[model samples]
Target: MQIKVDAEGDDAAAHDLYYWLRQDRELRRHAKADLTQAAEASDRMNAGEIINMFVSNGLAAASLLVNIVVAWRAARPSPQGTVTFDRDGTTVTVHDTSEETLRRVVDLLASAPPGGASGATDTGESSASSGSGNR
Candidate 1:
């Protein structure tokens, strides 16, 4: 399974995430993670660096989703923007670091089939939505 992480115009933030994942011993052992630059021939709209990760062994990609959030929260300035996690066609965006947002996303990803993304929202789970909520 492949998980594409885009910082959504935040290349610096993406680079930070790419390196953060690289620094993880467990992630390195279980998956093939690489940083990608926009193809030279690609159009402007698609231009930017994205991290492409391929899951091969023991890692549950969904569970590791928290790592991205963790990394974002660890940022010194903490990006005032969002990061997008795209799997197949289902995209779950992390808007801000909030417990409600975190749980909602965890539930959404966990409920889906392995290697699949189900864009479902839990009405009972309240999010800051200031930067959280389904996009």
Candidate 2:
């Protein structure tokens, strides 16, 4: 999958690793346990070390999440906007493509000349109308 990590910038390998971790129940359980242990250990460790460890672990987790999201996005065709999937029951949700963007894109396409491409269409549609109207 063509995963695009914002910080890592196209870290497909890292994304695959995270996907594997998520799919494998054993690995997921182990990772959860490890995170918990590390969090607990942070309290007993020196202040500097604890802070460093906490930050590092948090960043790692965040990076993993970014990669997974990118991978999931790539897996789907025509993902309208930011998409999320639930591991249980295979539910998917899309967000982040604000009504403004949707309206602008729709207006852009609608204003195009027959058999011609246009790029200068105005995009000032109101959110209430754009969102409430059926496409």
Candidate 3:
């Protein structure tokens, strides 16, 4: 005998009807086990998104903390001192940490054009143009 049934809404009622029709104990147990496994897999899938959100939020907080430290350092005034050193066998280096030097560097950058000192022209050529000819 063939029975035509449309099991759409009310899952509990549908499952009860299905159980009544399939009187075999082993079949019912197998069906229940499959449903349980599917439910667990679906739960894990939902939990993955929550875990990803937590990780992203933690990274964002760390990035914000780093930015705060950088801003604090930049706001502090530097000492007016100059240091000269030689390293790497034979290379000489001089570092000027004076306020005057910092001011000059800041002024130079402020006066520079948007793209840079070598501004771009309509023809896409650099203003501070230099080319190495075949020579």
RMSD to true structure for each model, in Å: 6.6, 18.6, 32.1
**Tens digit of lDDT per residue, candidate 1, span 26-135?**
66765666777755512221436677765542326545656655565556363345555554444555566667666655554445433443333333322234444332
Q: What is the lDDT of residue 49 in candidate 1?
A: 64
- What is the C-alpha lDDT profile of model 3 across 43-103, one tens digit per residue? 2122211100011113333233223222332333442111111111111111232334333
User: Per-residue error at 29 for model 1, in Å?
Assistant: 2.5
- Over 4 Å off in model 1, which ranges? 1-10, 39-47, 56-61, 107-135
Q: How many residue pairs clash in model 3? A: 0
lDDT of 2: 0.30
Judging by TM-score, tell me the better candidate of 1 and 2: 1
| Sort by lDDT, top down from the best | 1, 2, 3
Q: How close is every model to the real structure, measured as TM-score?
A: 0.59, 0.25, 0.17
Top-scoring candidate (TM-score): 1
In order, the Cα lDDT scores of the candidates are 0.53, 0.30, 0.24
Q: What does the lDDT read for residue 104 in candidate 2?
A: 34
Residue pairs with backbone atoms closer than 3 Å in model 2 (clashes): none
| lDDT score for residue 133 of model 1 | 35
Clashing pairs in 1: none
TM-score of 2: 0.25
CA displacement after TM-score superposition, residue 10 of candidate 3 (Å) = 72
